[model samples]
Target: MEIFKVEKATLSSVDDLKAYHAHIRPFVLQRLEEFRETWERGDEAVFEELVFCILTAGASALMGLRGVEALRPVLWSATAEEIAQRIHFHLYPAARAQYIVAVREVVRNELGGRLKAWIESWRGRDTRRDACVQKFKGIGYKEASHFLRNISFRGYAILDKHILRSLHAFGVIDSDRPPSTRNRYLAIEQRYLTFAHQVGIDPDELDLTLWASRTGMIVK
Candidate 1:
């Protein structure tokens, strides 16, 4: 991890980073393929992944998986307390439950349950993320990007804290603090996307590497 955060860690230019990425390319591709297989399972499977992203906002991706396991069967009808009792996230369980249900309803009503199609129809990741934030009750740009990337979308970058921290460590961004506004978030995301191109890795693939570089795990 110090390879990224330390100023003298060996990578001083995009070409140097590309050489490093080439060394780890096989492992990164393996993890990416794992993510792709999950998305390839069809719409129902993909919606479940979106729920994972929704549950993960302001939380860990690993915890999100557990929360999804606890709430999956009851998400559409369970009481807020019931949903809340199943997980250990920091936020109010009732509000999270409300947002979950509201988002489900919004997705069903607006996109007729075709989340993947809706995402694919957008001309760019930014537009797709904006639409997700507008339509879903609890989804912000990070969650939106997360959902899109989990579904094997090429153009999106999941700017979770792990990713932001790694990017800062690698000098892709100025600081590790979360972006304070939508404009700031987009600007930061653009930096990440540019870095992805420089490394010759897809945004989604680079996202996982950035995360792995920080946490030593190739998580979703």
Candidate 2:
């Protein structure tokens, strides 16, 4: 569990990232803030949010939305094959479908269909993210962070490829490879938080800023 601290940015790319982050900070904050209202809803919406993360694991956010929008009703009852036929994920449809099923199963059996109550029970980043990691299927650190962030929670980083590559471009991380272990993921996340703090950007808005800067679209 020897954590490797990240190197500071030295590339010319750092300036560009700073400029881009500045422009997108307000917009990303707006989007994340919209989720605060979702918490007022119930567990059905919470389950739907979990389904979004499950569908988006190795796919685009748009593809995940497509699956959620197209198969909203069938999500709880459909077989993996059925979901595969309904969505156009273009990557591991059956597997993602199975993941969706697995998520629903876990929420029903483990949480007793009280996903919202269970999630809101945790008061901090460590407890909430760890609870998500322990209870959910098809969700590790990155996915857990993404889900929590989308639900108006702060203090977690989504270490997806776009953010990783942006970090590499700025000479933050060495490579764009996904962190292979929990300790590594959290270590990198801490490094990003440190960098965000140094730059005076809110930690929660950090992912959206990088993502929007790279992809030209700000989304969950």
Best candidate, lDDT? 2
Model 2: runs farther than 4 Å from truth? 1-15
Residue 49's lDDT within candidate 1 is 78
TM-score of 1: 0.82
TM-score for each of the candidates:
0.82, 0.87
In model 2, what lDDT does residue 219 have? 67
Writing each residue's lDDT as its tens digit, candidate 1 over 1-220 gives 0112212124456665566556666777776676688777877777777778777887677777778888878776776677777764635566667777787776778789887777678877577778878878878888887877777776776777877777877788899888878999889988988888777777766765556555656667
* lDDT (Cα, tens digit) per residue for candidate 2, span 81-129: 8988887544768888778888888888988998888888998778889
